[model samples]
Target: MNHKRSLVRRTAAVAAAGAAALVLAACGGNGDSSAGHDGHTSKSPSASASASQGQHNAADVAFAKGMIPHHRQAVEMADLAPSRAESAEVKKLAEDIKKAQDPEIKTLSGWLTSWGEEVPTEGAMDHSAHGADGGMMTPEEMDQLKNSSGKAFDTAFMEMMIKHHEGAVAMAKTEQADGAYAPAKKMAGAIITSQTAEITQMNKLLGKN
Candidate 1:
């Protein structure tokens, strides 16, 4: 009987030890899983941040700086068309130009601000700074367009806008080629597409198509 008791006790002790080992193994497994979860959690924000902020370089900066003033000028010209253009088509085109560029100007300014760069002031440009490459209107040309009305205004506006858009297209192409910022490059692509189409339309309007 004493031997029987001792054997049973030993068996019970072995079973107890096995149970303890299993519990310890389960705890270790849980720890490993928790660690993996923690690692994944920490990595997610960095990935999202990279996606949201993206990367930028000097080319992107120049594109935004140059395009902002350029867009502002286009919008300025567009604003004149509503009051001065005799052609309904010209008025509609001007409205469309304003709608498209106003938002872009805001977006460009936001980018510049985020990058700690200067946003160009409203109605401000150093005409000598960009030269003909910018397709900017001279004060004399802008005054002429503003002072005219009817068919003359329509003709002058379309002609000048065509030139302005060509300059923007050039800048956008440069941005697509040289910029590192993903959003900026994407915007550049959009500008090329939309402005190219507009340029074709303007040429058609001018009977130059």
Candidate 2:
């Protein structure tokens, strides 16, 4: 009877050991599964953001580079209206143009910097170098605008601004069609809407509408 009892106790001990080993294996498997789940969750947003930030293409680059200088030129023209322009309406328009384009120029520059592209020099393309490419005024035309005052200044400003806004609208359309970056495309859309309105307003002011 004593030997039989001892054998039973030994069998119980062996069974308990096997059960403990199985429990440990299950816990380890659950821990691994939980870790895998957490890793997948963490990586999903990172991958999405990486894709978004890396999505820009050549059209986006061109949009930024070209628009920066284009905007700068507009701002330059706008700056002259404060002391030089006679019409309150033209002055107000100039103020609005400056307000709109200044921030945009900064944004474009920031994008170029992030993309490892060289930002065009500020005030570099002040003349008509880009006249054929965009509706940029020639040095002589800018001088003529600068030299005029009162109603003459207003007329020249509106006419030149109409042309400039048209050029910007064209560029923005191209960007909307070709740009891969979401923010840039959105900006392009806004440009189209706002600049188109401004062009219409200028034409009306010039009695050309």
Clashing pairs counted in every model: 0, 0
- Model 1: pairs clashing at backbone N, Cα or C within 3 Å: none
Question: How does each model score on lDDT?
Answer: 0.90, 0.87
| TM-scores for all predictions | 0.76, 0.74
Weakest ten-residue segment in model 2 by summed lDDT: 124-133
Q: Find the 10 residues in a row with the least total lDDT in model 1.
A: 123-132
Candidate 2: where are CA atoms >4 Å away? 1-48, 51-54, 126-133
Residue-level lDDT of model 2, residues 8-122, one tens digit each, is: 9999999999999999998888887987878899998879866777588999998888888889888989988988888899999999999999999999999999888989997
Per-residue alpha-carbon lDDT of candidate 1 for residues 1-209, written as tens digits (9 for 90 to 100): 99999999999999999999999999888887988887899999878867997888999999998998899999999999878999999999999999999999999999999889999988787666555778899899999999999999999999999999989998999999999999899999999999999989989988996
Predict model 2's lDDT versus the native.
0.87
